[model samples]
Target: MRILIAQINPVVGNLKENKRKILEGIHAARENGCSLAVFPELALTGYPPEDILLLPQFIDEVKKELKEIAGATQGIAAIVGLPRANAKPFGKPLLNSAAVLFEGKILGFQDKTLLPSYDVFDEMRYFDRAEERRVFLLFGKKIAITICEDIWQHAALSKDVSYPLDPVAEYANQNIDLLINLSASPFSQMKAERRIHVVQKAAKTLKVPALLCNQVGGQDSLIFDGYSVVCDAGGRLVRLGNGFQEDYMVWDSEVKADELVAAFDKTEETYKALILGLKDYFGKQGFKKAVIGLSGGIDSALVACIAVEALGKENVLGVSMPSRYSSEGSVKDAVDLAEALGIELRHVPIEEPFQSFLDILSPEFKGKEPDVTEENIQARVRGVILMALSNKLGHIVLSTGNKSELAMGYSTLYGDLCGGLSVINDLTKRQVYQISRWINRERDIIPVSSLEKAPSAELRPNQKDSDSLPDYEIIDTVLEAYVHDHQSPDLIAKNHGYPKELVCDLIRRIHRSEYKRRQSPPGLRVTDRAFSIGRRFPIVQGWV
Candidate 1:
């Protein structure tokens, strides 16, 4: 039997466009003489429509689109996920469901059993869990189907991540030829390996072949990587789809899968995720150009490179807002970067505005010594300049702060934190350097001087990041342990070669910075624990 994996990028609430894409995939599968085509979870209304599920008109449109998609399944059978109204009167109004269409009609519906409730997910508020095990006959084989979280019930990524029920085990008890899951699982560093492992384990435990087809594209901060997979009965991967974009694949039961999926380095995956996230963010919003404040630092340099790559050099505007403390080398680096990338470089000095602000606030701070307040005024001047340029030219400002700075509360609010979207907010200082080196592996796209120089805000005289925080290596290591790895400061200090006092202080800063992060722009997610949606902390907590 030939089963086609239809990995489609669906925009939330675009009913007609989503239906057209679904039909396009099914027709392609039919032309290839495939028996069945599987689409991603929530293929109709798109993934995580949030509160739109509560609208009666939105639910009504979903039903209409479901019928329309079913009518197009004349020559092939297709599985497309949607929201189905619950029949019971006492539960949540909707079921996260999939419409099985074949022979020009809706054949059956499979509701999602396991609804994830943690991290970025709030499905418990919108969807009711399914109560039955569904085994359907498709292409002369008994196949058990599931939605995204149903299969993830086996993977222990979090505490009690699995549901009380087990869909894989239920199918394992019965005689079934194949297990299929439709998903809208998002992308993160090393997530592809995790997904492969879970699918292999489920297929092995159930003693049947398994296939997972995932959604692709970016929605806000969420990015769905379309690296779908097919594992044989022996628990080995046979077919794998492409990453970060839409793809179509066919799996034959009799034929063994090709070689194992190639390992993508962290930098490569991070690069692709950022590009896709930026592209969709711009395209979906009907904006073609982006304006970035390039400071000649690695963070800003990297964001400019990604902007040029995502929106093309002509669409990216690199504006250098130099302050009184700005070094000539730094400003020159920004100009050289723009020249190499073939993008327009506009020079805007914030010296006059900084002086004006200081003159106005001089009497209010007459007795106080010059401190971070004066430095912050300069930073905010640059922020105001960037915003003015964006306002006049209709370009979105791209912030350049990274995870380490964000974690340590080392950045100025309303200054460096100003942007429509943050390009590298999820990446740490060390991660930014790693990807920078990788970008220059073929040639020096990033200037060598920028990479070698000490990182600084350049707001005050000879200000370095090391003045407030530890080394990038130390900060990133301690941060991953506490923030991403979920270890306590004392425990991390004990297990790792770190000082307890330093660890405790850094953890305190992380907690204190929650207010700043809450106000920051949405960032692209590339790690398992991104600051945007994956990590949650109380801003006023003293538990640290």
Candidate 2:
């Protein structure tokens, strides 16, 4: 028997487009004479419809689409994921479900047993837990179908953490011939290895061929890298599909066993993931062009470079929004950087807007001198101009704030935070510099002056970031410890050789600014935890 895995990228809520893709995948698999084909989790409505799942009309539309797909499934057996309605009182009436279709009929269905609740997921808020597991016979083999999180329970990371029962294990005991898992698993650095290890271990223990079909493409903050694979009973990889792309791979029982041991290209995998993420976010958000505020800083330079790489330079507009606070060398550097990157450079002086805001606000102050408030006004004024241009030209503005500034509340809300997408919001200040250097090393697109210039927001007269915040090296260390490591203030201070009070103060600012991040735009996920949806903190809360 031939089994095909169709790892595909589907647009969320675009029923017509997603259906077209699924039909194409099914046709491709059928042409190869495959008996069964598997698609990723929520393949019908895309990975996450988010709150769109709440609309009754949307659910009805999904059911209609599912029926349409079922009618098209003649002669070929397929398993596809979608949301199913469970009309019970006093709870969310939906289940993350998979349906088996064959010969123009719905054979059976299974609900996702595990609903991930942490880190960019609130599945518990939307879906009820499935109560049972079952296996279906097809092509003389019993197949156990599971959703993304369902199979993950067997390899759950924490032993102390109580979780739902392992559905795959129960099915394994039921003498299944194949274990099929559908997923919309998002990308994180080195996460692919963990996934492969889990699947391999499961295949070895269960003594059955395991197939994983993952979704590809970016959906808001999540980027699903589709590195789907098939592993034999001995835990040997049999077939590997492309990562960061829509691909269909067929595994036959007759092919030589040694041919399946080929490895995936790691560097190309990560590069494609980043590119696909940037492309889909820009494309799906209905932005024909992207306007980035290029300050000749490493962060902005890196973001501009990535923007150009993702959306051609013709679609990318670079603006050097300079102020009196901006150094002359930095102004030259911004112009030079734009020329080197082949992006259009426009100089917009914020001196007029800065003076206008200061004049309006000065009368209300009773002899109080200028401070960060005045600095923030400059940032906000520049923000207003970018937004205005964005509105005038129908371009989406991209903010360049990195994770370090975001973590310490160093960024001004409604100022630098005004953008349709925050490209590097997940990267720390240090990683921003590192990626900048890497981009320059790989391709000499970024100007050297951008790397050499002192980091500054240029929001005030003779302002430097070091004046208010610690140097990036020190600040990023403190940030990583407190944010990603989730270390206590005392532990962070002891580990990083900083005063406990200082660490405590940094954590306090991060908590206080939860309201700001909550309103910020979706950003790319280059880290394990990013600011947007992944990291959740109560906006109205106090430190104990």
Candidate 3:
């Protein structure tokens, strides 16, 4: 049987457009002489419709579109994900399901069995679990299909205990010829690797060829890397689709699986994901231009390069709001970097605004020394200037603060943190440098001075990041343990050989800055744990 994996990007609630894309893919499948075409989970309504699933009218519309799509599946069979109504009134009114279409008629649907509730997923709240498994015959072969989470029971998230009922496992010993899985799994660092392992294991367990098709595009903060994969029963890969973009591929059980899977590279994958995330966010949101506050630091420089790569140099505007404390080299570096990227650089001096704010607050700060308040005034001044530019020009601001700074409370709220999106907030300070160096490896995209110079906020005289916190080399190691690994301060310090006091203080700052992070713009999630929907921390909490 020839199967075409239609990896598509679907907009949420745009039923008409989604149907059009689905029909287009089906037509292409027929032209390619493929017997079947499969799309990602919730291909009709888009993945994780979130609260839209709660609306009864919305589900009805999706069903309406599904039937229409079913009618168009004439020459080639197509499987698509959509919201289906459950006749039983006891549970949730909807079931996350996929329908098989053949000869312009409905071949019925297979509801998702596993409803993931942990981390970013809340499927249990909206979708009812499947009662039993079913098989559909196509191309003279019996096929057992599973939804996204249905086949992820053995993933690392499951720890060691398997689900009470494995949907794919249930089909074992049934003599199934092929196993198909529909997925809309989001991008997390190394998540693609974990998915490949799951697909390989499932194929081996069932002793049949397996294929998985995932959605691609940026949905809010989540980015689905469409690396649709196919593997034979021997745990060998047959085909792997493109990453970070919508793509199409075919897999035939009769053909020999000789195509080599692409090698895994974390840095390369993350760079592409961030670009796609930013590009799709603007494209889907109807944004045409972007603005970035170029502080001339490595963080801002890296973010500028990424923005240029995503939106093009013409669409990106670099605003350099240098205050009195800003170094001459920093200002020059911002101009040079913008010139190198061939983007417009706006020089809006914030010195006057900084002085005005200090002059107004001098009376209120009668006895207080000129401390963080003065420094923050500079940052807020720069923020106001950049935002004003964005407001007038209709440009989305890309916040340049890295994950390390945000975690350490080293950034200003409504200041450097003010933007429509945070492109590098999920990346640590070290990661920012790593990608910067990687970009510069081809040529000098980022200024050499920015990399060699000590990292600074440039809000005060002789201000440096290391003056307040530990070195990024040390900070990232501790953060990886404390944040991603969920290890305690003591354990991180002991295991990673970090300074106990520094690690404890950093952890304390991370907890205290919860309110700040909660208000920050949506950031692209490159790591397993990002400061978005996936990582939920109470703003008011005690961690003594």
Which prediction has the highest lDDT against the true structure?
A: 1
Better of 2 and 3 by lDDT: 3
lDDT string for model 2 (1-544, tens) is 6878889999999989988888888898899999888889999999789999999999999999888888888889889889989867757789999999998888989889888887777898889988788788888888888898877778875332347488767876788888889999898766776777667877887898888999999998888988897888888887777877789989876455663554544444544566678889978877669998888788888888878888988988988878888888788877887888799989898888888887888889759987889888878887888899999999899998888888778888898999998888888877776667767776667777778777888777777888888778877887788777788888888887888887787778788878888877788886677887678788987562
Per-candidate clashes come to 1, 0, 0
Relative to the true structure, how large is the alpha-carbon lDDT of every model?
A: 0.88, 0.82, 0.87
TM-score of 2: 0.94
Segments of candidate 1 deviating more than 4 angstroms: 155-160
> Model 3, range 1-544, lDDT digits (tens) per residue?
9988999999888888889989989988888889999999999988879998888899888878888888988778999988888888799888998898998899888999988887778888888999978999988999998999888884535542356877877898799999999999999878888888889989999989888999999888889999998989887987999998788797778888785666878888899999999998899888979999888889889888888889999999998888888899999899999999999998888878778888898899999888888888888887888888889999988898889988888889989999999998999988888888989998897999999999888777898888888888888888788888898888888887867898888788888988899989999888878876678888876654
Residue lDDT tens for model 1, 202-243: 889988999999999999998888899889998888889999
Compared to the true structure, candidate 1 yields what TM-score? 0.98
Model 3 quality (TM-score): 0.98
Query: By descending lDDT, how would the candidates be arranged?
Result: 1, 3, 2
Could you tell me which 10 consecutive residues in candidate 1 have the lowest summed lDDT? 155-164
Off by over 4 Å in 2: 87-91, 158-161, 259-274
